[model samples]
Target: MIQAQAIRLFTNRGYDAVTVADVAEAAGVSAMTVYRHFPTKEDLVLIEQPARLIAERVAASSATQPLVLRVGGALVDAARALTGGDGDAPEASERFLLDCLRLMVSTPALRARHLDSQYALQQAIVDALGVDTTDPDAAFRAQAATSACLAVMHTALTRWAQDDGQTKLPALIERALTASFGDVATGQGD
Candidate 1:
């Protein structure tokens, strides 16, 4: 609702160019209402609730999946869920996600949050898989699996953004994860 409007404004107008009032108007709400939902302007873009929910959703069913599948699947599921899923128009949702990502990269505060988001995603993978990071073998495998998944995801994101969404993100993720297993370092390599 309000968040989508804010994302759109921030992406199109620049984060600095958009204010709470502007987002409010765009969302058809009052500034007070916007403030009630998001305490600070940064919160408008930096809130962790959505990410946490995605983590929870991933955690629910991913525990039984194999390491690599779980890590990559959870991230893909989160992105799919957050980007409007099958209900919303696919193209509009893709554009919206692109805007949200652009907003994150375009602003310093949001950029830090973006890094944090990646860390959290990785940690969530480690946790959901119950990878004992203290054990040498477990730690190595966990790190390799998560790194491979994240590398693919990050690559997909970069390409998706660069090509202006000519590429479907899920397709990119699928191709990256399935098509390049040999290319990803497995710690066994060296």
Candidate 2:
């Protein structure tokens, strides 16, 4: 409810124009409730909850599978969980997600906070990949995988947003990852 209201407010009024109080009122709750739900304004926009879901699933994923498979599968799970129940449009949920994503990407104030949100997920990926901190090569591999996976996620999301939420986000994520990393995943790249 807080998230839905906040997105509406942010969409109706620019991110800079909205406030905790504004979202509180829209949600029919007090400022404290809004703050309690989202530690910061950017959290409302970033949908950190969903991101956390992906991180948890990814970090806890079975290591027997390929890294790309695990990351892509985790993303798919998270995206599918967004059921678009906000009563706006069929694309409302994804559109809202895309709006927040765009706002975070373009807004400098929000961008920094977005990075802070991503750090934990990145670290989770690093740990899940079992990168030995003492080994420079292992650390680089982990970093490279994290960077590439993030790129794929971003590309998929951006493309889905551009399409006005017509495509299934998870499918786009898989396609993007496959197109960009299939060779590497299949051990065919030199």
Candidate 3:
């Protein structure tokens, strides 16, 4: 709840402008409590659940599946879960999601933090694949797959944010994943 409130506040007011006291007040908690949960203001605005879900899904996928397919499927599943499988997204509205994206894009500190989070996720994928990070091909494949997924997701979310009427984020994500990985699946080219 505090995190959600912090997102709303940070998105509305620029990151540098918003203080922990502001988020704490909005979340109805003490500033100390907010700091306890999130050591940094950037952490307050960053969404942790999505990354955790991605890690969990990747870890749970069948080993028999192609690495790309497993990674893509995991991403699709995470998108569905985040956007609400049936398309509701529970407490997070489309507007809020858009705001968060815009916030991340507009703020340098936030963007750096977001990139760090993504790098961590890619590492998790490498760990899940049981590949040595020092192996060039293995490392390249893991990083490429993770980067491709993130690109598709970002494009899908941007499209959804731009659309006026109701938009299905999960469907958009599925399409993005297909477009991004279809050629790879056919072994045509990388």
Candidate 4:
């Protein structure tokens, strides 16, 4: 509810104009309550679920599979989960995601924070991939693979937002991944 209020306020009044107190009042809660839930104003906009979900999916993947297949398949799975398995998200969720993306792209502060979020996400991916910290080669491979996958994800998401949510996100993600990594993106390589 607080996030909904924050997004609404940020959308209507602009991120700089909308204070945390304003969001709190709009949400019918105290500033303390809002702060308790979201440590900073950016937290209201930056979602943490996708990173966690992707990491979980990657961790659950079969260890026997090739690294690219395991990482790419996990990314595809996360994309599917985002769309509720129907190639499209529910109307409200879709709108929320689009709005968040729009805000992130347009707002400078949010953009900077997004970079921090991306680094955290990369760390999660590397940890989930179980890269051996002692082996520089394995660590480097995991980092590079996760970076490529994340770049694909960002491209798809930016395209989706650019289209004003007209394109289905999961399809965009899958298409972009496949185009970039070939069969490795889908675990179909022989």
Candidate 5:
């Protein structure tokens, strides 16, 4: 409820124009309550669930598989899960997601924080893969694979937002991954 209020206010009143207290009041909660849930204003708009879901999917893949295959397959699976089976979120949900993406890309502060969130997500992927950072080569490989997969995701999402969410996001994601890593990305072969 707080987040919905925040997004409503942010979208209608502008992110800079609305304060946490405003959102709190709009949601019938105290400022402290809002702060307890979202440490930063950006957190009100940014969601961490996708990263967690992606990491979990990656971790569930067999460790014996090649890194690209594991990460790519996990990314594809995560993308599907995010948009639902038909590669489309409900109309209302898609609008909400697009609004959040627009806010993140348009706002300078949110753009910077989005990068930071990506770094944290990369670390989560590394940990999920159980890569030993003590081994420099392993760390480098894990980081590279994870970063590449994330890059594909970002590109697809950017395109999705640019198209005003008319295009199916999962298809865009699969296309980007396939272009970057070929058939291995589709789980056809390593």
Candidate 6:
């Protein structure tokens, strides 16, 4: 509820124009309640459950699976979870997600916060893989995987948004992931 209201206000009024109080009032909650739920206004827009879900999925992947497959599967699982396993997403939900993405892209402050969130998410994935962040190789692999997943997400959302909310985000995301990692995995470029 808070997230939906925040996205609406941020999109309609501009990120800089919307205050915590405004968001709370729009959501019919107290300012304190909003602050309790989200530590900052930027956080209210940037924070999401998908990253955590991806980490969990990756952690639970079979240890024997190839790293690329494990990471790609986790990303697919997270995308599927977001879409409720169906191509049909509720109109309101789709609008909210698009609005949030727009806000992140249009607002510089929000974009910075979003990047910070991504970095933290990458660290979480690194930890989940039992990779030492201090090790150059481990760090490089984690960063690469995170970047690939984010690129897939960005492409999916951009394409979906451009389609005027017609496309299924999860399928687009899955395809983007496959196109990205598939080439590298198959040695198509090299």
Candidate 2, residue 171: the lDDT equals: 70
In model 6, pairs of residues that clash are none
Which segments of model 2 are wrong by more than 4 Å? 83-92, 183-190
Residue lDDT tens for model 5, 4-96: 889889999899999999999999999999999999899999978788888999899998888887787777777667666444445556677
Cα lDDT of model 6 by residue, 30-90, tens digit: 9999999898888788756878998898799775655666666776677667655556645
Which candidate, 5 or 6, would have the higher lDDT against the true structure?
5
Q: Residue 163 of candidate 5: its Cα lDDT?
A: 95
Best by TM-score: 4
Q: What is the lDDT, from 0 to 100, of the residue 138 in candidate 6?
A: 72
Residues 1-190, model 1: lDDT tens digits = 9988898788778899998999999999999999999887877776475456545655675454566666666666776666655343556667777877667767898888788777876676667667666798987887778877888888888887888777667667766777656322221222
Candidate 6 at 50: error in angstroms? 1.0
Alpha-carbon deviation at 4 in model 2, angstroms = 1.5
TM-score order of candidates, best first? 4, 5, 6, 3, 2, 1
For residues 18-122, could you state the per-residue lDDT of candidate 3 as single tens digits? Answer: 899999999999999998999998887677778788888888977666677667777778877776664443435545666777777788999999889878887
In terms of lDDT, the poorest run of 10 residues in model 6 is 181-190
- Candidate 2 per-residue C-alpha lDDT over 94-170 given as tens digits, one digit per residue, 9 for 90 to 100: 66777787787767988898778777777766776665699998788767777778778878877876786677776
Q: TM-scores, in order shown?
A: 0.75, 0.80, 0.82, 0.94, 0.92, 0.83
Model 4, span 90-133: residue lDDT tens = 56777888899899999999999999999999899889988789
Q: Candidate 1: where are CA atoms >4 Å away?
A: 46-66, 80-89, 133-136, 182-190
In terms of TM-score, which candidate is stronger, 1 or 5?
A: 5
lDDT of each: 0.72, 0.74, 0.75, 0.86, 0.86, 0.75
User: How far does residue 36 in candidate 6 sit from its true spot (Å)?
Assistant: 1.8
The better-scoring model by TM-score among 1 and 3 is: 3
User: Weakest 10 consecutive residues, lDDT, candidate 2?
Assistant: 83-92
